[model samples]
Target: MSGALAVIGLGPGSPQTLTPEAAAALDRADALYGYGPYLDRVPAKSGQTRHASDNREEGSRAAAALRHAAQGAKVAMVSGGDPGVFAMAAAVCEQIDRGDAAWRSLDVSVVPGVTAMLAVAARVGAPLGHDFCAISLSDNLKPWGVVERRLDAAAGAGFVIALYNPISRARPWQLGKAFERLRQHLPASTPVVFGRAVGRPDEKIGIYSLDAVDPSAADMATLIIIGSPLTRVIERPGRSPLVYTPRFVEGGH
Candidate 1:
C-alpha cells in the first residue's frame, strides 16, 4: 500500500503567490513535513499529522516524510519559496539516492513555486530583468573560498547577482566581504536592492548605492540584488523609485 510523496513550495509567505498545484497537494496529503516556521504557515487540517523540525534538520525531516509515504501515508513536504531552490527538494532527493533502494520506486514529485529572489525582484521593480545568477552567501555547508570565487566571477561577467542567505548570526561578515569583492569590479554608485521578508507583512525594501549600502540592514530573512553597470533607477515624486535593467544590452542587435 505505497503512497505518494509531494514536495510542495508555499512561495514567499503569501497565500496569493501559492500555486494551485501546491495548494491541491497540501489539501490531499495526510501528513505534512517542513521547518517549524514554514509548517506553521500551513493552515491546520483535520486529522493531518504535522512533522515540524529545525531548519538544519532537512535530511531527517525528508527521511521521516519518505518513511510515512512508504507506509501508505500521503505526505506533503513543504518548503518556503521554490522547493527546488536551496530547499527541501534537494534534501529529499539526496535521501532517496543514499538511503533506500525501495524509496526510488515511490511516487515523488516536485511542485514548483515562486522563489524568494523573484518575489524580491518584483517588489523592487525588475532588478533581475536581464541576465543574472543566484548565490547563497551562507558558508555552513561549503567553504568561504568557493563563495568568494563565484562572486568574483559573477561580478567580472557583469551579471545581476541575486544573493540568498546574506547574513545570519553564525556567519555575519560574509555578506560584507561579498560586497567588498563586487565593489572592486562594479561602480561605487551601483544600485543594490535589499528585500527583507518579501511578500510578508513586515517586509522591507531598501535601495542604495554600492558604497552607501548599510550591510547591517540585512539579516537571514533578506534577499540582496546587486545590479549591473547598465541598471538604472527612475525617481518619481511621492512614490518608491522604480529600478530596472534594460532588456537588451547596450549596442546589441
Candidate 2:
C-alpha cells in the first residue's frame, strides 16, 4: 500500500466514460471512499475495503480516508459526478489545512468526473450555453447571507445558474432565498428546469418559472437549472420542450 489518497471522479455512472488513468488508479487502490450508493458502482477489488457514508459527512469521511492513506494504504476517495465540482476535493483540502501531519504525509491528486450540471445542461439543449455560475443552495458550510449574495450576483449579471444542493431534508428555505434573489433580476416568465435523479431510470426534468417552482419538489437527488435573462422556451412542432440560453444570437430588440 502506498501513502496516497486519490480523489477519483467516477463520471456520471458509465463505465465507457471512465478514463484509463482513473481505471488504473482504481486497480491500485487498497480502499475506496464516497457516498453510499456511489461507492457501490466501483467493481469489487481484491483486498480493497469500501468506506461509505451520507453526502453531508464529506469532511469527516474524507479525513478518515486520509488517515487510511497515511497508514500506508492506497486509498481512493470517490465522488459522483466530478471530484472537484461540488464534491469531496474541498473537504480534503480543508482537512489538510488543519495541519494534520497524516494528511500532509499522503500524496493527493484530484481526478475529474462528469458533473450533473454539465449532464443536465446537455439534456436541455444547453441551459448553460454561455457564461454561468454555480451555487449550492445548501447552507451547511455557508451562511444564507453569503449564498444570497452570490445568487443576486449571478442573476444580476444574467449568468445562467447551475444550482447544486438546491434543496434537502433539513434545509428547505435556503432554496426560497435563492429563488427570491433570482426574481430580483428575472421576470416571472423566465424558464426554470428541475432535474430530479438525472441519468437514472426514474429521472425527471420539468420546466417552470421562479414563482412556479415548488420547494417541496426538490430533494437531495434533484438538480435545478435556472435560465438566464436571455433564455427562452422553444416549443417546436414535434420536438420536446427546450429551455435554452440565446447568448450568441445577435440583433435582439
Candidate 3:
C-alpha cells in the first residue's frame, strides 16, 4: 500500500499565521523532512520521526521523504512560507518527475499557507493591491543575466515587484545591481518597502523612495517591494505610514 506525502507551508514565522490545514497535515504526518531551521518551527511530537537537512539539500530531502512514503510512512515535507512559492513543493514535484517509478505511485498533496510577501504586505498596507510579480534575486539556479532582464521587463511593464532572496553573504552585490536596473524604469520617488522578518518578534518595516533606498538594508530574510508608478503612501500624525498601490489604473476598467 502506498502511503501519503504532504508538502506543507509553515507561514512566515509565527504560529498564529499557520493555516489550520497545514496544522492538520503536520498532525497526520508520521515523518517530517525539511531544512534544519524550518524543522525547528514545528512543535515536537512524540513518536514522530524528524529528518532535518541543510537548506541547500532540498533535492535530497524531497527524495528521502518520497522514499519513506513509498514504504507506507505518512510524510510531511516542510517549508517556510507557501510551499508553491519558490519553496519545497516544486522541489518535491521535480523529484517525483525524475526519480524512481514507485515514487510516482504514492499519494501526494500540497497544503498552502501564508507566504512572506502576503505577510509583509499586511503589516504595512496593501503594496500588492495592484498587479504584481515576484522574482527571486538568487542566481544560483538561473544566470544573473536572466534575473536582470526580468527585472528590466517587470519594471518597464509597471508592475509592483517583490524581490525574494534579495541578498546573502555569498550574494552581496545582486540587490544593489537590481536596484540600478529598476532605477532605469521607475521614478526616483517610487515607493520602496523593506519588510524584514515579518510576523517574527524582531520584525522591522521601512519605507523609502527608490532613489534614497539602500540595498544594504536588506538580507536574505527581508522581502523588498518596489511600488509601481501608481503606488501611494499616506502619512498619519503619530502612526506608521500606509503604503498601497491603487487597485484601478486610470485608463483601465
lDDT of each: 0.92, 0.83, 0.94
lDDT of 3 by residue, 1-253 (tens): 6699999999999999999999999999999999998999999999999999998888999999999999999999999999999999999999999999988889999999899999989988999999999999999889999999999999999999999999999999999999998999999999999999888888999999999999999988999999999999999899999999999888987
Please report how far candidate 2 places residue 240 from its true position, in Å: 1.2
What TM-score fits each model? 0.98, 0.91, 0.99
Q: Ranking under lDDT, best-scoring first? A: 3, 1, 2
lDDT score, residue 84, model 2?
Answer: 91
Using TM-score as the yardstick, the better of models 1 and 2 is 1
lDDT of 2 by residue, 5-105 (tens): 88998876667666787888899888999889888888998888898898779889988988888889888998888889878888899899885865776
Using lDDT as the measure, the top candidate is 3
Candidate 3 lDDT trough over 10 residues, lowest sum: 195-204
Mind giving the per-residue lDDT tens digits that candidate 1 earns over 33-124? 99999999999999998989999998999999998899998999999999999999999999999998879989999999999999999987
Worst 10 residues of 2 by lDDT: 244-253
lDDT (C-alpha) at residue 24 in model 3: 96
lDDT of 3 at 39: 94
Q: How far is candidate 3 from the true structure (C-alpha RMSD, Å)?
A: 0.7
Which scores greater on lDDT, model 1 or model 3? Answer: 3
